[model samples]
Target chain A: MVNWQLYLLMFLPLAFVIVFNYVPMYGLLMAFQNFDPILGIWHSQWVGFQNFQQWFHNYQFWPLIKNTIALQLFGLVVGFPVPIILAIMLHEVANDKIRRFMQTVLYAPYFISTVVIVGMLFIFVDPQTGLVNHLIVSLGGKPIFFMASPRWFRPLYVFSGVWQGAGFGTILYLAALTGVSPDLLDAALIDGASRMRRIWHISLPTIRPIVIIMLIWSIGDIMAVGPDKAYLMQTPLNLSASQIIPTYVYETGLLNAQYSFGAVVGLFNSVINSVLLIIVNFIAKRLTETSIF
Target chain B: MEWIRKLPKRSTKGDMVFDIVNLGLLLIVCLIVLYPLYFVLIASFSDPTQVNLGHVWLWTRHFTLEGYKVLFATGSIWRGFVNSLLYCALSVAISVPLTIMAAYPLSRKDFVGRHVITVILTVTLLFSGGLIPTYMLVRSLGMVNTIWALILPGAVGAWNIIVARTFFQTSIPNELLEAAKMDGCSDIRFLIQIVIPLSKPMIAVMTLWVVVGQWNSYFPAMIYLNNTSLYPLQLVLYQILVQNQSSIGITSSPESMAAQQHLAELIQYTAIIVSTIPLLVLYPFLQKYFVKGVTVGSLKG
Candidate 1:
């Protein structure tokens, strides 16, 4: 018999998702309207495509797109392979104690919150007395103002992400790697294969599907580059390098109280993510015979 | 000599080289990962003057708790600590159970509507109304600046529900569930009595995730809450670190301005450490659970 009690159990969570998640989708009509907060969504004049037109025609649109894509690509390029390499090296460790110790040490930073990590960055890269600046000065160079400079923003953001996240990223890949049969490794060794050769042939192939899956997900996630850290790091000085789509919406909609225009920009971001996800999944299906949906 | 000889021997010179190089790389990475935290630890305790001079390194120079004393002396920090605890506790209490309930049905093999529900839910991951609409909805409910605004909107995460569902499906097997069903148990009873006990490890992982997530989150607070009394520790941290609210160490004398400035820097380090203490203490015990969670969760796609 089908259990109605299970339906009863799922009731609140389903209600939560419908209210918090799906109802918001229905409210996306504000993106099409000239929304006045006091006038509210229903009473707001529905000026078809006017909000989108404003956002698309805005001078900030292309730069926001470029910055978003550039930052994600930079992160993908640097941050993606680090955990894979780390896991491989970890997988290679003959000594279990050292392997576990390295894993424990590496994963610790992942526990540190983003705000704290950024705080650490502020303290460590302080132009006058920061650790980075101290070394720079000791080496007979000028102590660079890291947080103030626009040119350094993406590098600082992406690399700090790697530092914070790479260790934890290894867990998934490492889990996948554990599925490689010991018999295959034994066979490779018996064939007088070098350790590198075995890793390249056996280990690499075993993990390729997961790698492809992660790459596709990262590509799809380009538009959803969270505004939190970027918002925190933005200075009037670095707005050129730092203003991404999320922050732009937050500034326009929330901060400047341009709710409709903000929704238009934010809706653009969501659509781009959806499109990229579908496109990437299509490419993945064709190229790798792997797809999430 | 015996211990040295007991070490795992490599079959080839190439393997030996790889081991040595691997160990070296791991050591450098460990140092790189660890040094910033170590510096913060020492710097919090070191003399503010020495710290400002960039002389504080591996150990505290003229150790003192002045930074912490100054940090804790503020009324806001204590208020933030208690508020954060409340938010974190409420959030986990609500979210973990919601996640489990959603997961239980989705995990069922014979639940005909589960696929439709899942596909509907998964679409939210790819695209949605985005920020303004969500904020507007929260506002519509008169939830702005309320604790419920923080707790309710984020209480049920679809992705985590999927992860927990997968854990239930794979780990707790259909056969086990069928056996329970045959024993004259109602679905609610089966859940509370049987499934809940069996899912302890997953629940523990889910609890840790929800708690850490709630503790770390401030963006929601920034958007929703205007009241200072409602400020969580992370929001307080945003003030200290990003806003650089060095007003806490503002000068009593212009003559001691430099001293005040240095103490301000020291206080920043202390504030980061203080805000992070719950996490740092709980992390070691919980690290294994994260690995397990990630491993299990990533099995979704």
Candidate 2:
């Protein structure tokens, strides 16, 4: 039976996805043509692969790609696992009151606006008199130019990401943790297994599927970092290190009016990200018997 | 709470020791996460020089309200604040209903095309057009610099839609629908008259998720809004704390210009407090519903 309710339900979200998500995809052609407002998309000069070639041959192309992948990989290395570790730690804690309180404090940062997170970074790291520098000096170490230094940018960005995200990310893993049968934990304990062994042998294996699903999702997002936080952090001193693909796109396309070039770069990024996601999903399914699809 | 009530409470000596040690470590982690926020609050009220000197810790030193005074003195800041709230409100209004209608049917195992729709939504979750194409579409739609541009483009988050779908699928039993059908209810009627009333908690959680998303989003506003009037509060704060870099503030210290290169740093911290306060004020009351509702919705799925 074609449930009338089902058809109505399907049409609404589907209509939304079509109008908003899929329709925008047609705009990708602007990257190929010399898009002009008067000429319109259909009538614009189709420049073939010129836009992609321009992006490829640009002096800063490789550097931007390098920075984007580096920062994302750095984020993945630090950001992905902190939540899992935190969730395990949180699950083991018997005190509900304290655990809840800790959760609230940690999750609180996630709610703070990104502009504010970037802002707080400046407040805490002024090399002259910033709180972080003051502490370092007091501890008999030289103050670091955190925001300005190329060396420190990735670490600062990644650790701050962990601080904001680890708490909220715990909710997913914690949800998966709830599925770990208490009977298994008890049985392991009855067999004189240590707490660490019980966690390693039983709890870890049970939550493995959820972790794999989330890992696939994270790998898919590797190229999609927005330009805001990194752009905000950019100064003459740190532009070399801080500039990434998104910032480059914004500067070249929107700010400089190199619209075709920007679109080409964006399309390139999308292709790479999609390829990465598919490859990661294939490897995950092969290795772990789990996949996002 | 149900799970806690069911848990066995008796503990061994090692368990007691481990619990104490674990509590201490967790407390320290909590403090490490929260202290920077605490310092920002204190420094926002403190005199600029003392703040710059790093003299204040745990409490305000040479306290003043200059940052707030400067922040409020700008007519632009107030406009941005109102715009942010407007964006959040309109987004919630559109998103909540569409999500409810969409999620409820997908939750039904008998629904044709459910799996297909699920795959389509899941694809969007993993891969997108990467911003520029999306922006071009918005511009093409003539939504740029308009408030609807912000509200409409992101109305249905695929992840949230799926989550809501899972919530409905897991929470609402088919037997209940059968009972409602036996009582001679139509599809929309059963949805309006029974399902919505039963789905209050999931609705509330999704509301929080959507509202928080719209409220904190500044990048889209920066991209789509050329009009300063359309700029959200976070974007205005971004300009203040970032673009100027404290070099041109009215409060520039001749006595401390070299040392005060970081003057805008205070405003950045102050901005965090400003941007976060509205959501934080509402969070405690919603916290119970958020976890309880999401857990129930997710656990069953």
Candidate 3:
């Protein structure tokens, strides 16, 4: 007998998917049309490729693309390896009490909301009345308007991201390291191999698969950097460095009511991300025989 | 044999050097993470003028609770807290059951069309319809200004379903289901009695994950709910903290503008602590489950 009971169980979730997920996919057709809220998706006039063309030719196009890619790439290069190193360091701490205490402290920041993190950034980096500027002044340097300066935006954004995320990111690597056989490590130690050599040969290779997987996933998400923290961190002065694609979509689509153009930009981002993911997955499978797929 | 296995290995000079270096580096890492959080706490309790003058470092100087007083005097923060709690509760209620319902079926080997359904769900992980279209869909559904907009649209995620499915597949054996079937027990009964009760740890992990996510989420609330009364904590936080809007309704005069600026800086510190304190408090107790959740999800199906 066919498992009708299973189908019954799947009913609500499938319905939710169809309505929330699938309908939005269908509404992506609005990227083609001159989507008017009054006329709705079905009745809107379809101007094939005009919206996309407008986004392509828009004054903000190159800058938006540049800022988005730069921020993500910067984040990936700096933020990716910290966790691996942290996990390895954490793994080496034979004292469980000290290791656990350190892990708890490090992981605490990850739980703080993005808004609070950004707020803390603004408070800490404020030139007139901030601790960082105080330190700068005491050192006989001028107080830099870190938030307003476009040069500092990417570093602040990426580093704060690293600060909040690196600890939590280590968990997977730590788990992988924990799986490394202790007997093998003891054998290596008895063989008079140094701690560094043992870690290099044993702990690092054990976690290599996870590291590659994380690398591939993060690469696939290059264009999909979340706009929440960046939006919070954006100032009028730092717009050059922080005006990324998702934030642009929010500004145009929701705030300004230019639905079609926003849809086109968003659609473009989604397409590029999907394409990148597929290509990266293919390359990873070829090189390491490990892929998200 | 057990004592021997537990005995410490011989530590050569090189090993001792490595241990010292590793511990020293970790201690620095811990300090870097701890200092900012500590600064925020001390600054919140310090006098704004002293804080502005950078005298509040290491501990409170010219200590006062003026920031907390101003913060508590504002009604928006309280309202936001309430709304956030309600949203989180509702979201956890809806999402956990939906995840379990969907995952249990997919985990079963004999379930028809599981592969097709799995592919459909997994596609969303790789490709989404992007923000505008999703927003349009929500608006069209008349959920724009409603609580449903926050709780419903993003409730069941592909990653969550995959995690739940993997848990069910690994933890719930087919033999138990067969035994339950032979006992003439219905599928629903088995799920309620056997699957759910056995999966309490996973459920708790899922619930905690959903609660944390829903509590921290401001984007959906920012976009969907235009009504100020409905604003969640994070959105309210964004306004007061980032936008620098004084919800305290202190009308600024030229003289008070300087005072206003001081209070604003102090309020920012207090607000960060107030908003994040709940998560930080529960974090120590919940850390183990959170770790478990990540490890469970990271396991390949």
Candidate 4:
């Protein structure tokens, strides 16, 4: 009954996780050390709480937290409802072929890489050659330096995120929507219910659990905004708005070669993310009886 | 039933208005999504100066292959392209099998230690050692600037394992495994001959996701590889497109400075197209599987 073959299959993957996932956790000890590459983790001078205290008191700490939270909040607030709305709209399209075609067109951008997306943003918004500026000029307005101005960073980031991800994000909601019974919709129709009313009463309620789950997941991820696109979109002029924690870790840790300090900052971010996830999950379970636990 | 089938679809004035509004909004959303991509395509072919002046809007004006010509001639782009392809291949090779191996055991309820192993792996999905420690570990392993640096550290993701486990559990019926066991089929033999062959769709989904993920990723390369030759396409594109550094080595004489600048701008558009074309080409064929992957993965295990 003991599947020794299954145990053998598990061995390599377990080894992989132990080395790749857990070892780095062991490497987290470097956060408490005045980590020297030559001295390594074992020999490095242990300075308990020094790195944490240093980061907590650092001048950039509050700005980093503020920027990280601000971007994530903006993304969640602006980006969250878009997919739900999109899914509902798609569901309402009675013409199957038109719905499919629209879905295809919308999802195409999701395949574009982050580098290309940011690159496209720069090209389209460029002061001289960009089409957006051209439209502005033709419409009797001055050209705005979208990439350079710190003011434009968050909007640009969040909107571009929605543009790329909203269509793709609808996949889950649409899947849930399809599970709504035709019999229920027919009954609503027989009662002479309007399309809007039917959707409000039937489709929305059907997908509410999915919506709640997604919202909880999004809330949990509020502190863990990816550094890739933001880092790519970052310019010297936009650093004030773009210098979030992950990017800060990359800059100060690897780029600046402050390994231990970078580790401390990254550890801080991860701890906050973990704590937030637990808190959000617990709250969701209490309120909605639906959680990602 | 006959009357129900034959009757015209019921629509009140309110429903008509709602449908019109919904379709109108969706049409706008579709255009918003499509235009930027269309503009990039047209701009790539248009004259760089004309593009800059906004003379080329809906279509290419003074159409030229000059930008693409410049891009194709660049050694870094070519190197980056090959490097990216190599990394993706290596990553897919490593990740797909590792995912299957990890997922299969976890999928089996009778497999001893499954719960403990599942919990161990799932915990990784929630938290990690963070970037710096991971980077330090990679550096300590002397994977810096090597191909292994890009592919090895992230070969198996906990999420992918979970997704594949879900697939195995749901699709590969327990009865089939028991039947195979009656014939004295070993677990490895059953997996190779029965489970894997039957799970083609799941494998395709996993492979496509891994390939796409590896293709698009540049963070690992940017972090670990110091050598320009090992740089992936995204990293190279980053320098060219994001930093506005011209990888095309055009001589900058004072008189030709404007011309050089124009060519550089053209190359940026061209680079975006070239780098993106592969994924976009594969997307239509692969989209269903991608959708399936998302839906299957999203299901509560």
iRMSD for every model? 1.9, 3.6, 2.8, 3.0
Please list all clashing residue pairs in model 3, or write none if there are none.
none
Proportion of native contacts found in each model? 0.74, 0.49, 0.74, 0.76
lDDT of 3 by residue, B138-185 (tens): 888899999999999988888888898888888898999999999998
TM values, all candidates: 0.96, 0.90, 0.97, 0.97
lDDT of 3: 0.88
Q: In model 2, where do residues sit more than 4 Å from their true spots?
A: A9-12, A284-290, B1-17, B245-268, B292-301
Q: Is the docking of candidate 3 incorrect, acceptable, medium or high quality?
A: medium
- Candidate 3 local lDDT, A221-249, one digit each (tens): 89877779888888999999989999999
Docking class of predicted structure 4: medium
Q: What lDDT tens digits, residue by residue, belong to model 4 across residues A62-157?
A: 999999999999999999999999999998887777888889988988889999999999998998778899999999999999999999999999
- The runs of at least 3 residues in candidate 3 whose Cα sits more than 4 Å from the true structure, single-residue gaps closed, are A288-290, B1-9, B252-257
* Candidate 2 lDDT by residue in tens digits, A1-293: 64787677667767888778776577778888997755667888899999988888989888888899999999998899988988888888766776787788777887877777877787688798788999999999999989889888899888888888888788878778878898987777677665566678987898897787677768777986888788878877887779998888887877787777788888788788778888887887787775655
User: What's model 3's lDDT at A159?
Assistant: 97
Ranking by DockQ: 1, 4, 3, 2
- Which runs of model 1 end up more than 4 angstroms from their true locations? A285-291, B1-10, B246-252, B256-259
TM-score, prediction 1: 0.96
Docking class of 1: medium
lDDT of 1 by residue, A1-293 (tens): 56888888888999999999899888889988889878888899999998877877999888989998898899999999999999888888766677788888888787787888888888888898788999999999999988888899999999999999998889988888888889998888788788799889999999988888888878777777888899888888888989998999899899999898998888888887899999988888887776666
User: Candidate 2 chain B TM?
Assistant: 0.85
Score each candidate by Cα lDDT.
0.85, 0.78, 0.88, 0.88
